[model samples]
Each structure stands twice: as structure tokens, then as C-alpha cells.
Target: MKQDTALSERPAVGATPTGPDPERAAPRYTGGQIRNILIGLMLAMLTSMLTNSIVGTALPTIIGELGGQDKLAWVASASLLTMTATTPLWGKLSDIYGRKPLFQVSLVIFIASSVAAGFSTDISWLIGARLLQGVGMGGLVSLPQIILGDVVEPRERGRYSGYLGAVFGVSTVAGPLLGGFLVDSPLGWRWCFFITVPLAVVSFGVIQWLLRMPAHERTANKIDWWGATCIVGSAAAVMLLLSLGGKEFAWNSPVTYLFIVVALVLAVSGVFAERRAEDPIMAPRLFRNPTFVLAGLASLLVGVSMFGVMIYFPQYLQIVKGMSPTASGLMTLPLVVGMLSASISSGMLVSRTGKWKIYPVAGMLLVSAGFGVLSLLQVHSSIALVGTGVGLIGLGLGLSMQILILATQNALDRADMAAGTSAVTFFRNLGGAIGVSAFGAIMTNSFSSGFRSVGAEAIAAGASPDELAVAATGSPAAIHALPDAVRELVLGAFNDAMHHVYVVGAPVALAAFVVVLFLRPTPLRSHT
Candidate 1:
């Protein structure tokens, strides 16, 4: 493969050859080449980000059709498991092999998975497709940052990163509307999977043409395959417990305890494997750095709060408040606006002023405050009120999303750039997976409890105990199909469960606020 002149050129004096921001004499790609590459990268980013959350509003409809309401959280959990497992590997391999090939290969994986998911006839097939999609997503999300580091200097990257964040925000906005429309229309939820294929094809062509990398001499080090496998094993164990413990079996049951033991053993083994690997996925050493540790923790908390809300708000609108899928998605526009605006404006501000500490601190506080607002949500809340509540979360997340990664990158040495970046990203996704599943467990439990607690008069009004039990775990359609008094009971139960979830989980955001308070401030490096 032909190499770019700047990419292949020798590193400037005193610069690390693989530094996140090498001392470049000029950009590797210029003018329209740069623009097209970025357009490809941004569009690729959108494909994953858009697909990730688009299903939130339509999830109920899909479950209703698939007849697997009990498996609701697993739909999200399966993808999260594989993505979290594979994110670090993608970057590590990219360092050894060229970024372009891995990127193109990942896109192909994504496109193939999307097609597979579109044709799924049951929940198992859908979940399997999601797992495959996660494998591809691991690359799409990680490589752009690695490649951007390859091409752009740190100072100028802020503006471009802002544009990337904007793509995230815009996609966040567009996906739900599109997903809801697709589900509500003749296309059905299947189209949600089908929609990504063409955009991915365009991205595949763009990256193949415009994106280039210096030909990397393959690393002689063994590829830490054991460590990666162990990590995936432990992660999958934890996800299984989180998604299944309380719902599928009693938390104290033999099944739950057995899985817990298995997870702990695997996690311990994964840690030991990492310590011994020649090319460890995430060096055990990063934990020793206070900055690295704190950043990862903060990122984890933000993930829990951000993703927890992302999963539930649409459910609240559609299930508790009786909005159609399309209408529920439309209700989320305010949130999209807040997040997109905050991300773009904050990116510009940081690029120009070279200050970033205050943003995440501010963002975490807003997130906690937003969680407080969501805690007050009710079965009868107005659409405007729900929108305002969720908008705060979007605002807080937008401000911190790019800044946290930037902060972690600033704290690490050039050689550890990939490790540090992947670590932070990994924790963020792991937290999301655990948080969404954990909260889903809690909400579902509360749903059952709430149903049982309804007054005898309501139950006596002709709702079967078994039927109400099924309603607790089933879709909105199931709940709505019940008799009048039982329908009210079910809606009331759902609303209460929603309220309980936010109230119980809001403390994690506050914990993030405390952690962000301790993030060491470093001087923002100008592009050298």
C-alpha cells in the first residue's frame, strides 16, 4: 500500500514516533482529502451512534412483535458485552497492522451484521446479530480517535473533535425520529436494522479511498490473545449476572451465586493474565496513575447515568404516558438539542481558550441535578415536563463526553496513548452495560412489586394474578390490553418503577461529581 508523506516521515526531534500528537511539519492529508476523510469518519461514527440508541423508542414495539418482553434488557446487554470486550483489541491491533485495513474490515462486519439483524425471526437471532454488530462497533468507535491522533495535532483536533461530537449529537437526534417512524410505518422494526447498510456502504467506500496510514511494521510481540479472551469471559460473566440475577432467578438462588463465583474467578484471572501479557490490552500500570484512575472512574459514572436515562426515558413516554413510538421519539428532540448544542459550543470554547477542567465538573453536577429532576417523573407528567427533565442529562453529557477523553489523553505518555484512550472508553462502555442491565433488573423487579401492591379492589375488578404478573414483564401492548382498572394499575406500576430507578441510581452521578472534583488539571498542549 502507498503511504502518506507526512505519515511516513521521521518524527521531529524529541517526539515519540507513535505520539498521540507527533510534532508534524504539516497535516498528513490536506484540503478536500482531509475533508473527505473526516466526512467518511464522521459518517461512520454516526452509523454506530445512531444505531446504538435508535432502538430505545422502538424497543417496546420490537419486543411486542418478537414475543420476548422478558428479554428486553438482554437486547442491549448482548451488544454491550461484545463491544466492551473488543474495543481495546481493535486499537491494539490497529497499532500493529495499519488502521485503514482494520477500519474497512470493521465496517464490513457492521454492514453484514446489520443485514443479519434485519432478517432475524426471533429474539435469539436478533441478539446474535447485535453481538456481531458490537464486534464491528468496537472498531468504528475506537479507530477514528486513533486515526485522528495519527493525522491531526492536539490543538486543532478540538475543533474537528467538536464536529465529530456534533455528528454524534445530530445522529442522536435523527435516529429516534427515524427509528420511530420506521417502526410505526409499514417498514416495521426490521427496517431499523436495514437502514444502516447503505450508509455503511458509503462509509466503506469513503474510508477505502480517502483514509491512509503509514505502513506499520508488524509487532513481534505475541498478541495477548489470552488476556483478551479472559477479559471477554469476565465481562460476559458480569453482564449475565446483571441481566439475569434478579429477574430470571432469585438473587440469592444457587444459580445467581454460581454465576457470581464464576464472574469473580474470571475477573481475577483476567487481571493476572493482563499482568503477564507482553502486550497487555490495558496495562495494569495505568491504575497506578491517580489521573488515569480518576478519569476512568468519572467516565464510568457518567456512563451509568447517561446510558441509564437513555434506555428509560423513551419507555417512560411510551409506556407510562401513552405516547405512540414516533411521538415518544419526537419528545426527545429537546434533549438532542441540549446535548448537541453543549457539545459543539464546549468544543469550540476549549479549543480557543485551552481550558477544560470546568466543563466536566459543571457537566457532572448538571447530570446529578438532571437525575434529581427525573426522579420526580410520574405517570401523568406532561410531555414538556418529561422533555425538560431529559434535556438536562443531554446537556450535561454533551459537555463532558469529548472533554473526558481529551483529559485522559493529556495525562498519559505518547506510548500509552492507545492504552489510556482504550481504558477510558472501555470503562465507559462497561459501565453502560452494567448500569443498563442493573437498572433494568431493578425496574423490572419494581414493576412486579408495584403490581402486587395494588389495592385488592383494583385486582378484584377482574385482573387475574397470573395475567398481572405477565403484564409486569410484558410490553405496553400487554399492559394496555388489560381491563380498565388493571390498565391503570399496570401504568401506575410502570411509572413507580421508573421513579424508583432514577432515585436509586442518581447517587452514582453524584459520586462522579466527587471524582471529577479531583481530576488533576494539566496545561492544554498546543499543536506542535
Candidate 2:
């Protein structure tokens, strides 16, 4: 069996190495190499988030051109679905195959798919491309974290993590603006997708040159291909069910029931497989730690609230509030700023004091409170008030989301760090997928019913009565295009929809807050 003993076996200065020493095989990065790695990883991370946020400012234009405002949630959900479901698989594979190849391959896949997406002429093609791109994106996000885990000890990992948080902060702040500008310019919305190509090409080249790691030598054992297949199948099915339920299919329909049954069976099989597999995608043993379990749950909830909220808020600003793409991006600056502040502050505090639980505990409280406050938003509310609400939510999310991962990694041994971290990340992303689907449905249904009640065209000119009703609630565009009487009706419908969505999110946040209360405090580990 191969073992990594490189870290412990470094010789004294000028010492000679013995023949075939295990230490000789460990990948060592020079300072320049490390810089290359960070830069490469940063580009990859930037690409992972860029597509989603960029779309936020471009959505109204894209939907208007593509004529699929009704399918808007799918744009976000598609990327999240593949990214979330495949995360654990990516982590496990990286462990078996080593990080360099997986990382590079992920970039290539993302780059290729992104280019295809930019040229897509219709919504279906774009959504399909996004799904493919998401598969690559899943690895970019997860593999970098795993690679960081390999090089850094848990305690000092926060500094690198702080770097990652900074990347996320910058991307979230910048993605919408870049996306909006592309949409508004002669380049058009397609450029938003094309923009990732050059960045990815450079990232791949950098990683290939700078990341020279020893081959991962493992005992000959059968890969649990079936288990991985089942897990992916199960995750995809469940996400699809959630995304389509109450929108495309009735919750109680035979198709929905069939999908539900398949999801459950495959998920159960996956659990069993994880326990028995030599290298499980998600090791069952990690959940044995109570801190890991709670932190994972908290992470999941945070993803649901945090990602779910971010995906749609720009649309709310642009469509409902009559803001332009640039103005809408600017309006969201507070949320990004708040996230940056919370992440930096929490990281510094954790590093300085080595006390970490307080942030997530308090953060969750603020999350619930923030969402509760956001629920008060109305069509007539001031932009500053709306930004304040979003910023508060961002602050809570920043404080809690990554901290839970940090706590979970700290609680586990070095060997378990990647799996544990990936698990929490996977579940969180899963929660994001579920939340978007659920809340999207809630908004759609509420808007449709509300619009119908007010009689803003029981049927639209080009759309079905049901479709017209949904569009009325989805954005301000629908309302803006209508006559004054109909516009007022659509506005009322949107208000009801937003209110209901917030109501759902608030309770989920509150429940997460209660869950955090039970988490036992563990000191953050001092190593990578």
C-alpha cells in the first residue's frame, strides 16, 4: 500500500536521500508554483460563479429574446443540479486519481461547454449547455478545496480559505456587472458565456505547468462504479422531481410518484454502498461525529437560503422595481460588500482567537432575522431598504456558511478532511438546488393565482391563461408591458409571490437557527 510520508521525512539541509524513499515522490511546489496554483484555482472558481451572477442582470433580456421567462428557474437550477449532485463524486475521484488531472480536465470541460452555451440560439440549447458546463463546474469548486486540504494543515487552512472567500466575494460582486454590460453592449448576452473561455484556457495552462504532484498509488481494488452511478442517478432524479414538481407536474401525479420512488430507492442503495465501498463517494463514518452532522445540516440550510436568495434578487430589482441591468447590479453591491465584510471579519477572529462557534451560531440567528426582515418587502419599498435587507442576509450567510465547513474540517482527522468538507459542501449545494426549485414553484403558483384573481387578462395574447398568470408574477417586464389597469394587477400578483417566497425562506432559516443551537462548540484546528 502506498502512503504519503513526505511531510514528515524532509531531511536536514544538505542531507542526502535514500533510494526510492516515499518522501521523494511527494509533489513539492516552489513559491512560483504555489502562485500559479492559486491563480489557476482562482480562475476556476471565478468561472464557477460567473455564469450564474452574470445571468442575473441579463435574465430579463435573455428571456425576452428567447421568450421563456416561464422557464427562468431552470437556468439557475440546471447549473446547480449537476454541480451539487456531482460534488462528492469529484472529491472521491480526486483522491483516487490525484488532483492535477481532475482539476485540468474540469477546466477543459467547462471551457468547451461554456463556448457552446454562448452560441446557443434558444433556451433549450443554453440550458443543456449549462448542464454540461455544470458537471465541469462541480469539479472546479470541489477539487480546489480538496487540493488545498492536501497541502495545508487544518489550523492554518483558514488563511487559504480566506483567500477563497475573497475570490467568491469579488466574483459575486463583479459577475452581474460584467454580465449586464455584455448584454447591454453590441456584444449581446452571448458574450457573458463566451467570456469564460479565455480565462479557462489560461487557468488550464497554468495548472498543467505548475501542478506537478506524485502519482496517486493505490492498492488494486475495484472502483465502486455502480455506487457512483446510483448516487448520481438518485441525486439527479430527486433534483429533477423537485424542480419539476408543482410546475410541470402535479405533486401527486403518477410521474411525480414514479420519480420519487426511484429517487428513494437509489438514495437508499447509495447509503448502503457508501458503507461497504472501499472508497465511498461519501464515507458513512464521517457523519458519526455530532459536530460534523450538525455543521453539515447548518451548511445545507445556509446554502438553501443564501444561494436561493442570490439567484432571484436581481430579477426582482430589474423586473419589479424597474431598474436597469447596471443599476440592478449596483443595487446588489451591499449584499456583496456585507458578505466580504463578514467573511473577512469571521476568518480573522477565528484565526486570532481560535474560537469559532460563536460566528455560525450568531450568524444563523441573523440569517433568520434577515430573511424575516426581507419578507416585509413590497413593490413600493425604497431601493435602500431592499438593499439593506439583502445585505443583512448576505452578512449572516457569509458568517455561517464557510464557518460550518471550517468547523467540520477541524473536527475530522486529516484523512477525513476532504470527504467531510466535500460532504458538507455537497449537501449545501443540494439544499440550494432544492430551495430554488421549491421557492420557484411557490412564487410561480402564488403569482399565477394572484394575477388571475385580479383579472389581468384571464388569458394572454400569445400564452395560455396559466402561462400569462405565471409571467405576471415572475417579473416587472410582464407588468410594465401591460395597460395601467392590468399593470396594477400584475404588480399586486408579484407582491403576493415575493411575500410567499420570503415567508417560506424565513421559516427555513429559523429552523436552521434552532438546529445551530444544538451544535457543540469545537475549537478550530490550527493546521491546514
TM-score of each: 0.88, 0.86
Decoy 1 TM-score against native: 0.88
Q: Which one is best on TM-score?
A: 1
Instruction: Give the Å error, residue 208, model 2.
Output: 3.4
lDDT of 2 by residue, 1-528 (tens): 122244344322112234555223223444455556778788888888887778666777878888777788687568877887788777666666666777888898899899998888899988899899989988988777777665554555565565666667678769988986788799999888899888888888888776655545542266778789888999889888876677777898999989989999998998898888877767788878998899888877887887667766766776678887678778877777877888877877777777778888788777777777778888788877797788888788778876787778778755566667778888888888778777877877887788667663534333346545555546456657665555555676777788888888888888788878888777765443
lDDT of each: 0.77, 0.75
Candidate 2: which stretches are off by over 4 Å? 1-36, 55-76, 121-128, 456-475, 481-489
lDDT of 1 by residue, 1-528 (tens): 234665567342212356464444434566567668778888888898888767665787879888788787678666667777788788777665667788888999999999998888899899899999989988888777666655665655666666676676677668888887888788889889888888889998988877655445665357888787877777777767776666677878998888878878877888999899887767788888888899899988888887788777778877887777667777777777878888878877887887788988998878887878888877777666777777887788888877888777667765566667777888888788778877887787887787778846557889877777667665777787889887887788888889988886678888998998998877666643
Residue 340 miss distance in model 2 (angstroms): 1.0
User: Which residue window of length 10 is worst by lDDT in model 2?
Assistant: 8-17
Q: Give the runs in model 1 whose Cα sits over 4 Å from its true position.
A: 1-3, 10-28, 31-33, 54-76, 120-126, 171-173, 184-189, 460-474, 477-490
